[model samples]
Every structure is written in C-alpha cells, then in structure tokens.
Target: MGYQAFYCCYKTDEVVSPEEACEMDLNIAGDRILELLQGDDDFFGLIDEHDTTLQFIRNGDLIWMEIPIPDQKGSFGKHIPIDEVGPLIAGLPSRIDLNDFSEMRFQSW
Candidate 1:
C-alpha cells in the first residue's frame, strides 16, 4: 500500500481523492498543481493521511510554499520562482509527503 494524499485545489473547484468519484493519482494531481500555478489561482494544498500539510500560495511570479514539519512546532517554507516548480513537480513522490520534499532550500516559518 502507498501513503494516500488529497489534492485540494480551489481553482479546479474540487478536491481530487482516491475514490470512484475522484481517484488520487500523482500525475493527475501534479497536473492540477501545475494548472493552479500557471493560472490565477492563489492557493494549492496537499495533505497526506498522516496530517502533514504542503501548501502553496502564489503571488505574481513567485510562489510561497509551506510544509509543516511533523513532530515539530513550526513550519518550513520557501519562496520559489514559478518556473522552478516544474522540475519539482515531475519528481514528486507517489505519495504527497512533506518529508519527500526536503531537497529544496527551506527556512523555518
């Protein structure tokens, strides 16, 4: 079994999940994220079963991402150029997990 996650996109007007109504696949979710990033949507969120959250807030050409560290009191965040997320999107884990996103440069938020 794999870790389950939910794609919460307001721009898409729905949250994609692992069900007949909406299956949760990384590729599809990644595409939705890309769409949200490239479009006028201001927020994109992915939350895993463990309750760890990865959230993004888009502001103009920059995107601010926040990942709440498990077992910690604060969050780790980074401000990235919009184009910089494309590669990271391609390399996302089968499951959307904050730990899997540690390769990026992040600061305590």
Candidate 2:
C-alpha cells in the first residue's frame, strides 16, 4: 500500500492519533514541507517498505522514515520513528538534478 505524510499545527499534547491527523488532508502540508526542503520539482522515489518503516531515494540519497500506525481502528499497521530513518539518508552522497518531477503532488500522512 502507498502512504502519505503531513505536517500538523496541533500541539504535541493534543492527543490526536496519527490515523486521525492523516485523515485531515495533511498531504498538502507534507508536500509543502518537501518543497521547502528539496524543491518545487524534486521527486522522491520509493525504495523500501517494512511493516513500520519506509525508505525513499532522492538524487540517490536514501531517506529513512518512520510512521506510527494506529491499532486496527484505521489502516495504521506499525510505528516507525523518523529518528531511526533520518540518519541513514544523511549518510548517503548527495547528488544533483534528480528525475524530471515538476508538478508532482507530495504524499501526506
């Protein structure tokens, strides 16, 4: 299954579950974050997937990511922490001019 990411304005103490937050149309927010971090046209390619982790490659750099999946209440299946994934991506050699990805929509969760 494909997944999306999102940035939320709610407080950390708000107690909202990841599944609920994701359902709130946060893909736009996630996409915006990606745009700011990478660029308007940068493409993120999916590389790996596990029960709780996903890996993506952009410009040949690996990006590790974790998502918290709520228990059966929704599609949430597992929990992966970004801290575990970020470093893996940071260690890769940086490259330039990724695939032509203009006008691509960012995924949100």
Candidate 3:
C-alpha cells in the first residue's frame, strides 16, 4: 500500500492505449527512473534495500504510476511530479538523452 497517482496527457477523459499515451514521453521517463533506482545502490540505497517499485502505465493520455513505497518502521515515500521529471533527470551524472521530454507537457499539469 502506497501513494497512488495518475498523469494524463490528453485533453479528453477517455482512456487511451499505452502506445498512444506514450507520445508524450512519460514511458521514457518511467524507464529511466526505474533504471536509476536499480543502478544506483549508493544513491538510492533505501529503494534498493526496501524493494520499492515504480511502475508506469499509459492509458489514453493518462500516465499511471504505481509507486509502492515500503512501510518500514520510520521510512517515507517521495512522490515525483511530472514537471520535476526533467530536473531529476538533469541532476543525474549519467549521460542520458533528455531531449524534448522535459518540455513535453509541463503546461498540461
């Protein structure tokens, strides 16, 4: 059990397919975030030890992310917003191609 959030990129309320919703680059960011959480035990030690899961799903302009934050004794979960996705990626020392992804739908949110 954890904080649940959904991000939709379309103007309509209709559910969209993963492929169609992915036109906004939400999938790319999700993959990168997972990779970061997995590849960096030193940086995200809590995530690695607690087995935190960050899932991303695109349905009709809606990007759903299920982040199951572990309920350890005194631990808490950090929610990453869609706008901050760019800053988070930029903060990384790795060479990731952050094209227009960051600028994709900042206004939508």
| Deviating ranges (above 4 Å) for candidate 2 | 10-17, 21-30, 34-49, 53-109
- Candidate 1, residues 1-109, lDDT tens digits: the string is 3234444456566554433123345566566666766544456665555555666767778887778675565677778887766555556664566566575555543
What TM-score would every model get versus the actual structure? 0.59, 0.20, 0.24
Q: Weakest 10 consecutive residues, lDDT, candidate 1?
A: 16-25
Name the 10 consecutive residues with the lowest summed lDDT in model 3. Answer: 40-49
Give the alpha carbon lDDT tens digit for every residue of 1-109 in model 2.
Answer: 2333323222232222234323222244334334323422222222212324222322223322322234533221222232333443333222211222232233335
Candidate 1 lDDT for residue 26: 53
- Of the two candidates 1 and 2, the one with more favorable TM-score, higher being better, is 1
**Which sections of candidate 1 miss by over 4 Å?**
1-23, 38-41, 70-73, 94-109
Sorted by lDDT (best first), the order is 1, 3, 2
Error of 2 at 6 (Å): 4.0
**C-alpha lDDT of candidate 3 relative to the true structure:** 0.31
Clashing pairs in 3: 7-63, 9-61, 16-59, 16-60
lDDT of 2 at 103: 27
15-86 in candidate 3: lDDT tens per residue?
333223222233454344333332211111111112333344333223333333344333222334444443
lDDT of each: 0.60, 0.29, 0.31
Residue pairs with backbone overlap in model 2? 4-108, 4-109, 5-108, 5-109, 66-80
